[model samples]
Target: MEISGIGSFLRNRRFGNYLEASFGVNFASPSKVAVKEEVEKKIQSVAFVEDDGIGAVLISWVRIVVCFVTMMFTTFIWALIMLVLFPWPYQRIRQGNIYGHLTGRLLMWILGNPIKIEGSECADEKVIYICNHASPIDIFLIMWLTPTGTVGVAKKEIIWYPLFGQLYFLANHLRIDRSNPSAAIQSMKEAAHTILKNNLSLIIFPEGTRSKSGRLLPFKKGFVHVALQTRRPIVPVVFTGTHRAWRKGSLHVRPAPLNVKYLPPIRTDDWTADKIEDYVKMVHDVYVKNLPESQRPMH
Candidate 1:
């Protein structure tokens, strides 16, 4: 399919040249643009069921049943494996990656959603990932895109979940107490220390919670504080179409094309706590400008 609308605008050579000249931002190459176009074509070809008919309703119900069954079965198996490898932290983390990949593939297969990843490739080096939140599926999308040894930072409430919460704890992700400032600060310190000592990458959703309106929300400063403490490069990631696939507060899943794009990383060698809001606004603007008009916030 031909590139149009926001995609065309982003890939335009003149716009890229202007960005490079004005802000020193490097635009995607022609080869990358071609790849994106092909991916878009593939996404467009996927069959999506319209929710207006009884047949569609039945299909959606069946899909939910299959997804729930698959998730429960996978979580049980994953928990067993974690139990077996609990004695070794590094081994558990490595095995978690394998289980994570399998679960991600299984969930996507059941939903009939194809994930298209674009932009900067993830390397083995340690860094901080800041991403826009839209749906619960964002975690799975991130897992499928990132390499092994990357841990996520989640709220303390997630620990109260049943089987999934146990697995998350066993997976060794960082959990922060959002209700208490001192505890949250301590969690960030421990998270930074874990990243440095274990040589692992961390993913943080700066918005803190999923966006109900499918638009990027104002970012919280927790992620910025973590980046500053760790002195790591911040990689910004954006997710499109996930909210439509499995929307917030919705029980049904739909077939939708999901895209995960990784932007250039921002180095924090000379950043200070006083400049945190400015940096957050800068990254927020990147999402506002790059997201398609349909997905952009209605102001």
Candidate 2:
């Protein structure tokens, strides 16, 4: 079978360049296909030889080590400094938003990458902020930008992820266990109570997981339920360039500018469950459109 031009471009030009080949004579007779068989054997042997496997594993290991060390040192050093220099209340303030912002700035600068924040004018002191999930670094950026206390709605697994786990508990975080659907819903109900009682803002990723392709994943309705129950405002946040800057499969911090944009808040005062899905889709589309051309997810 012959491949089309586009197929040729995608296969041979894009990825087939790494394949092995057999260089020998080809006979004109029907029974003499030695070169073809030799080539097939070579192809099979080379096909399973992963060119990027070792490099990927080593890089992933290095990233884990670096991330662990950075999270530990930053949390410890900042907490210690805040404890020594401020009163109890002031210390809590520093530890929460201030320290987080400082940590993010330090990480970005040290990585020689800058994050630009725009559309902050739409940010309210108290509201539910929803953004596309892209990476663990999403936590730091959201906390840094939020003035009023921001509580993240994260998965239960995060409660066990190293320094992040301890900090999450310390910050009075909300955990949703998706494995048990009922339990997850109950957790969100409890979180709604906390949000209302404390007049605190919640940051949730409706997508539930980070996008490997950078495209907005299908959103879960748990966020809508919580928003409706609390009758709080919903602010849409778009995080651009985060995936390229720190992709899920790799650990090396590539230098790139990350952009965070805050859209106007949407209220649940008159929204119905039926239209919630439509509303969420619209917000996602808006985010996709507003994203910089270079950072927009390829469909």
Candidate 3:
């Protein structure tokens, strides 16, 4: 599980503090769940399925091309499937899980990086999965790892992203209007209701945006409120290597080992109004402790 020379390299650029503070949990080396499946010869779809990129430049561009084209095709198919599954809300979301998993799995395979997931994936639990937001790939990777159907709380602007946005809406994820304080609050309540009624795990990135510096950003209180209101356990999912793999402000999807570890679930039964801030820092610390040494939160 050790990555050679990455520590010193990050320190040289002063990004060392970021890795350690990112995840506060100590997850033992759990069984490695390899994301790469057996590569089969498929001549039918060579245009989008080729994995023959050699140099990093070629490899990265290949990923970008394939990702764009494959997403278009898959999203269209998913939209159609979702339309048919519309009568059963839960069934539609469950199918969205499989569709997203397949898309993410394809991206992982094409990126040609090994992914290691630690801890158990929760299924059939109405819990909330909170994690640090580092890169765009983080969300897609989360979709690949989480055990059950997960509804996310994202910014309302995401609804404008063409076909993918339609797919997102069809999946039953909640959206918050970040600019409107009251609307955002109402969105949180709606999210809680969705969790309870649908019996699905919720995924939220409390930082509100991607970390441009790969450091842990200060969390907003919205997700904390949702977890408290819903009385759902909060599972902190920590990720390493994604910020470097694709990084912020970068377009290339370079090959790098992506690691995901789910920390112990925090019980909200004891997290009353008076202790909300304390629990926030506690959960944040668990994420920081589990993060790599260099990425730890600055003192």
Candidate 4:
């Protein structure tokens, strides 16, 4: 029998079970020609499946490696250029924001992805940004939206992540130690201070971590605290389809369109810290409604 036919035979549960039974029965009958042929066919079928499985795994690894190397190379060069240019003042900040937008575009290009931005109606400078948690890409998306030097509230653990860690530190991004609420509160206070001192914008992923299901999890009140503390206007940014492109624990970069909608700023002058939960829910709901149904991650 041809090897292809043997593959089908091996895939058949009934046939496979019968063959196994036949092999067991004929094992002691060494002179049975039929038994010898059946045993040989089963071995060949098993070998073919094993070879195909191995080849698939190898190809997957090669593709993942290629994607990682290319992404790293492009990001490294972009970071080097941005660092060397180093825009500081408001005018430079505008230039930097422009650079950020360009960088976002380049990133999408490198990953073979595209991002759509909407609601430019209120792309103001002084605003507090609240977004959903998805991945490290969340920060990049924030940068993509508010290039004008926003102070990002991120985990303290990321400080140890090789090259990106050093760059994040250099950016003077806000670091939060969630394990210690007191430390987290202090971090938020310091972040607010940084915003006022630098006159910079802010981006907070209130969920604290990437949501595996793409659903907006309960948000921490830190962003609300910052908004009320600083008395700054809050801007709600909703991002969709990013999780599909690069999800947590995934290495392969999939090409997908990213949609960003920048809602108007939420004024906090009259809002109290007690009202934070309401604000958080409002933004989370907006995100859920705007997110594409097909792209929402499985729970």
- The estimated TM-scores of all candidates read 0.82, 0.69, 0.78, 0.67
TM-score of 4: 0.67
Clashes of each: 0, 0, 22, 1
Candidate 2 residue lDDT tens string, 55-113: 75565456556656776888887556555654453234324555555555444434433
* Residue-level lDDT tens digits of model 4 in 1-299: 44323322322332234345533434445665676565665434432112235555465456556545754765576556557546543333443344345444344444543444567556556788888767546656665556355556689998898755655555556688778889888888888887888788887777788887666677787887788778888777887777766678866555445567788877788886666679877666766676677534345
For each candidate, C-alpha RMSD in Å? 9.9, 18.1, 11.9, 20.1
Per-residue alpha-carbon lDDT of model 1 for 1-299, expressed as tens digits? 32122222332333234334433334455685664565566556766554746676677678878877887898899889888888887656655655565666556556666666667464435788888888878876665455567777899888788766888888777889888878887888888888888877888898888899788788887877888888988888888888888888877677677777888788889998899889888778888887877677777
Most accurate candidate by lDDT = 1
Instruction: Write model 3 residue lDDT over 108-146, tens digit each, in one string.
Output: 555655455556543336688888878878867766555
Residue 184, model 4: Cα distance from true site in angstroms: 1.1
What is the C-alpha local distance difference test score of each model?
0.72, 0.64, 0.68, 0.62
Error of 2 at 201 (Å): 0.4
Indicate the residue-level lDDT of 165 in model 2. Answer: 69
The local lDDT score (0 to 100) that residue 222 gets in candidate 4 is 87
Ranking by TM-score: 1, 3, 2, 4
Off by over 4 Å in 2: 1-70, 77-94, 292-299
